[model samples]
Target: MALDSLVSNFFWSNSDGSGKIHWAAWKNYRNLKTREVGTGHYIDVFKDPWVPAAKQFRIPVNNDISVNQDMVVADLVQERSWNLQPINRKIDKLYLDLISKIPLTSSPRADKLMWAPARDGTYSVKAGYRAKTSAIEGRTGVTRASPSKKVDTRIWRRCASNPVCPVCGDETESLEHLFLLCNWVKVAWFGYSMGIYISPRNIKNLGFWLEEFQLLNDSDFDYSKAYVASMLWAIWKLRCRMTFEQVEPSPSEAMEMTNRAMKEYWEVNSLFPKAPTFAEPEASYKWRKLQSHTLKLNCDDAFCKKNGKGGIGIVCRDSEGLFIKGWAEQVSAYSAFHTEMLAICKAVQLVEEWGMQSVIIEMDCQDLYKAVTQCSFRHCPWSLHGLLIEITDPVQNRSLVSFSLIPREGNSTADRLAALA
Candidate 1:
């Protein structure tokens, strides 16, 4: 690379803080160099010396010198001098991609990459998901019949003498046995990880596995992919520690380390502002079509905590806030949110029965509101069982219905009816 090009790509400040150089200024200064150095000099003297070294080394071997000096030079290049700027840039781009586009709810891939859903680019949650999945997969496989077909006298010999399997100890271990089968991996997974497990099939590769798990699972999945991935990373770190430092941590100690790592990851990744929750194109289109309407229906419900009695209320008002007529019904229900949703269902049914069009539905529950308007809440028991049931017949035609949220104070009529119920 030309000195001018290098100068153009980076900003520099003087030691005394008295001067600064933009890439353009630095590049111009470099171009003023009276003598030009060869590419070899640039790589050996400037690039290798300045750039941080990468884990993988790319040292050029030269046979120009006697053995001793040449070996020393090769060793230094391999051990410390290789430039890592390219790999660092790649990692940064990966983190950026995670924050800008990937959804948080994905399961981790085997390669240790997961789509981090937060506004910030952090991998704590991803690690948690991966570790949990790996542990579970490990446990599952261990509990099942061994894949190895050979029956051994070792297996039948006094099982008590070998309390711990030569392959796996009493830790309920399997996949960890295959990839990370050891006391260290078990301590991290079983001890720190709250006993959650993910199927091994989801893990793709070491670099991006956790990330794949995060990608594969949705946000509402039982296991939090981010949390699992964090655990996996911590386990890997512990492995490195054991290998290099000759230190072995007990299960409790490893759990503490896992917590600390997860905490730090969350702090770095979550402090930044989150991106706006994006709506799918089809959802956005449907939302726009419904919002184009004029009349809005606001519904609510209130239940007595002591008993299951509740009241359902629905009010139809124009955009200007004038009442178009409203209805309040008292009912009995164990679930208050269910009752609230029932009101919307009934209101929608009533509107359709009356042949009314262009209605906007308002509710206090966000989940219920989204469920009703999007027709995507079918999975929610109450939203599906109660809310959907009420509007099923009514929504069959050309009417537009939307859902929104209003302050509790804005729902005086519903409040009064609920009090009565």
Candidate 2:
């Protein structure tokens, strides 16, 4: 009821009746999706915010118009496929391509409104409040607004305090001074890259500096921002330590801490799983060639916790080590071992379907290899015992099919395919 009232009030207050609300309040909430598109029934083709590619369906020319305000997206569809002729004439080629890609169900249902802020299309008051507060902090360029408000050094000093920065002890304490101008911060940021320099004269504000940094290093923007944010956090920690604990903080130590923190943050929040950390392969490690008229299958799996999904990659090579064919598929799996087992099972299925003779299946997973070879699941968990049994069936039926364990280095092609999937 409260949510409905809040939404009603917002729509009523807006003069244009457009559902566009200022998102500055939720800009700091990194997880917010912000953009939404629903099935096109009531949405105005030219005026409404249903077209994600262009953000809105606006005609480029001032004196000319393409689509009518009353026209909805459903009007552009005839049967299941898009009526491209009218749509192409109305919108630009880029937007037309994007629209064509939008999947439509065979049995179309009523247009449903969706919340863009959350993955499940549901909003929470707690998330909304946190996003709003985070936005405030970002605008003010402060770590914590409450602490800054409560601890007014001027009030305690009984006079106008100079507010010298704890790090450099030379400049006034401000967002710029604390994050950018401080000697310690400069050392921490510029120490690794002497080529990159932050000039105070060019930087109008901390936000502007961060934006410019992102533009300059577009490819590595995420990692660069993460590193910079970690550095700022470390600098703030150092400042707090100096003021409260009367401890002198080393710039090197702070940089080291920032590196560790960034690593942990990447591990936890990254969209893709980190590559397995393995030691250097032995000098003898290499892809072994198969016997005459024999085919070799190299299989690998990649699991990403962010999406709770996994990918299976299998490559077939002849006795001469020549590439034959490869297959990659995205699958749902709980664990890496499970994904590996699935990949092995998929390989067996492919071999059976292809009617291949004298095939050798190679994989890097040691546990899966042992399970397949031993064919004993007395000690294996109930969950994996069935999978193990299924994997061993092909070997038992087809005497020509064999399983082998290989080092990850020898399975580079499959590994690459899995990661790409």
Best TM-score among the predictions, by candidate number? 2
lDDT of each: 0.48, 0.69
Instruction: Give candidate 2 regions above 4 Å deviation.
Output: 1-43, 56-63, 106-109, 130-161, 165-171, 174-196, 200-421
- What lDDT, from 0 to 1, does candidate 2 have? 0.69
Q: Provide TM-scores for the models.
A: 0.30, 0.37
How well does model 1 score by local distance difference test? 0.48
Stretches off by above 4 angstroms in model 1 are 1-293, 377-379, 382-387
lDDT of 2 by residue, 159-222 (tens): 3245776556787776676667777677777775423566778855666677788898888877
Model 1 lDDT tens row, 79-131: 22333332333234432221121111111111111112211212343434443
Candidate no. 2 TM-score: 0.37
